[model samples]
Target: MTAHRAKGLQWRLVVVAGVQEGLWPDLRRRGSLLEPDRIGRDGLAEPLTPGAMLAEERRLFYVAATRAADRLVVTAVKTAAEDGDQPSRFLTELGVEPRDVAARPRRPLSVSALVAELRATTVDPAATPALREAAAERLAALAALRDDDGVPLVPAAHPHRWWGLYEPTRGEVPLRDRDRPVALSGSALHQLATTCSLQWFLGREVRAEPPATAAQGFGNVVHVLADEVASGGTPADLSVLLERLDSVWDSLAFDAPWKSRQERENARAALERFLRWHVMERDLGRETAATEHDFDVTLEAGGHRVRVRGSMDRVERGPDGRAYVVDFKTGRNKPTAAEVERHPQLAVYQIAVREGALDGVEGFTGRPEPGGAELVQLRIGAPKREGGDELPAVQRQPALSSYDGDGEWVGELLADAAGRVLDERFTPSPGRHCDTCSFRGACSARPEGRHVVE
Candidate 1:
């Protein structure tokens, strides 16, 4: 019963629970919807003075304590969390030590808790045989107990229902078959070989990819705008392109107004750079064969068949009549010149072209030889030369040739990467990229995450 309802009553024993700060005295000023305090005079109801409110709460507490003729017990809990409970100041004022009381062991509050304790006692090797037998009998009795409606009250106490004794749903099966062909993408080949393999396994194999962020959304819109302009859906006019951007700008979520504005402006700069690059290429007599070209090819790597499927961003027929692969990169960080020279993704695309993946397509009558591939970084500005126009940075990977050593190295890298994927050997390779990895919390490379695997 509430303290207010028990006023002036006497009892042999009384127990006050939840005597924690913010609960007992409850100093919060509760406004009334009826506004009875303002009935006499004034525009709004007046709150009780702090001193008066304290006195009233104290009086109620005193009344509750005095009702117990024999003994009165006040309880509180001190929780471990930062915003957890604390004993009320009233306990100290009543000459009770809050610390000693809070440190005492809590009583079990449920049948399940009692059953768990009894089950533990029954299995304890240190326990006497007689004690273990007594606990087992009690557990059996609890399992047979029923409610007024005949439903078993302690259903979990049944031995057959124990969790630890249950058999696993799938008994000891390997995740992937060793002889099965490993399906891969052009981009996955690059990430697995050049970056961390554990990251590739968790993200691709386990399908634990992180949620898309604002930066990813921004990149997507810019890529779409670039595609539209390239396909002639939207003109090269800045005003027209920006109008289209504004139409879908609200779809992307940004942390703040300033961040949204900044990203929008950055996207504008990217579009301008793309237009500049496109116009420059057109003026140089280059023709775009396809905007988004799809390809699927199978390669024999490490004595295993690896199916590679991916889409190229843009394919252009150079003045020399050789096909050129153009990959648009909207990210700020551009790959180093050395990394670009031996890039796996570009090499895979070149291999696909040589293997007739693009043969009999709209622009190609027969197999078109890959002249070269280049990463067009729209977010990075090219360093201005004395007589050059401002444009996006372009990192080119020279065309692979059978006679040159470049093609042989690419084949070796592909085989090595394919072997790792097939064997499911995803050893964590730490690098600067680990700082942004989503699986860092589960990765064994870090000391804290090591416990997860153990």
Candidate 2:
């Protein structure tokens, strides 16, 4: 039976076992824990300490055991031996005495009964490779450890260490002891908040029925568009798509008409900008001119040779032996030049580009060519006018365009951000923005609410 089906059902006989550490209620990876701002809105204060989590597991066991209608049989294997046995803590708490079930005599079974239990289960061949590889690796690691007095000393396992594999662009160099771990940036956090707020807002209207128009179903439309772009599909028939989307959007009921209109427009504008940016970047990758997108840039930084495989959105060759690597930003909120300067991701990209880690796209080989990088903000919507009768309003100019060419400046920013992430120095910067944040209620910075601890 599926876990969902078991959620609310209580059986006449209930059995709960496996309440060991790292088994029940599973331990979360350090990096998997959300930031205070993200957790705040969810009404969670602080993350659950390991001790609290263990206690919660025990409590869950108690709850499960007490839910039985008549008989309860809780069991646990204390040791891997003929005489080894132990009672679960919850069973002890319930005053149920431990009994040796393994010592019971075995009864002879009929051939049909044995045959019925031996039925074969189908296995997918494609799944074997990964499973075999995982088994081999685990066995090898186990073999490397020495047992102390017959007790296996499993090597210290850091689940979050796998996070490094996800960041291929970071190269193979180990981070220095002084370097901080990376956490979700402000922009990333804001994006999550915005998505949560939009979902909550849309849920209220769409509860009665499905969205009837694309404009009304703005969130769904944007999601579809993002999926299309991520899959490298052409977004050519936007008009037809928008029409269908508007139909879905119009079906939803909203608290305020003007607010709904603004939100719908905003969602549409963001989707359009993202699609355009993705298309432009894809096109650059296929360009034949010196502006080609595919490149391999490599650099030596912090005692590691970092190699980046990607195409720049735009490349402009200058007369002074300088090449400009341009990246497009379709986000609505524009930060000041000073704010841009402090942005870690942009800084890292600039360093990567300058060090030739991204030079392969431009057909360059050997050492990476030193060049500048520009963060260009592409305006997605038209500027507001006092009064205008134009068929389509003129689009507003991009708010800010920032540039950073200094490698040291970029590295410093990354280092600082990385340090904060490692140190777990998360602080909530709440304001009107908190309204959009999913973790707003769980935030420590929220003056009026209790913090959530998970």
- Deviation in angstroms for 110 in model 1? 21
Task: State the weakest 10-residue window (summed lDDT) of model 1.
Answer: 98-107
Residue 139 CA error for candidate 1 (Å)?
Answer: 21
What TM-score would every model get versus the actual structure? 0.68, 0.34
Q: Which candidate is the best by lDDT?
A: 1
Runs of candidate 1 exceeding 4 Å displacement: 1-28, 32-49, 59-181, 362-365, 386-390, 402-404
Full-model lDDT, candidate 1: 0.82
lDDT of each candidate versus the true structure: 0.82, 0.46
User: What is the C-alpha lDDT profile of model 2 across 244-276, one tens digit per residue?
Assistant: 557667666666899778767675566555555
lDDT of 1 by residue, 1-454 (tens): 9999998789999998888888878877755777566555556656778887888888888887888999898887777796988877789888866546434345476787888788888989999999999999999999999989999989988987765455425426655565766678888989889998899989888899888888899888988888788888889888898999999999899999999999999998888888889998899877888887889888776576777789888888877878888999988788899999988899888888887778876766578888989999888888676113258998899998531356887777677778887666788988877888898888879765774443
Clashes of each: 0, 49
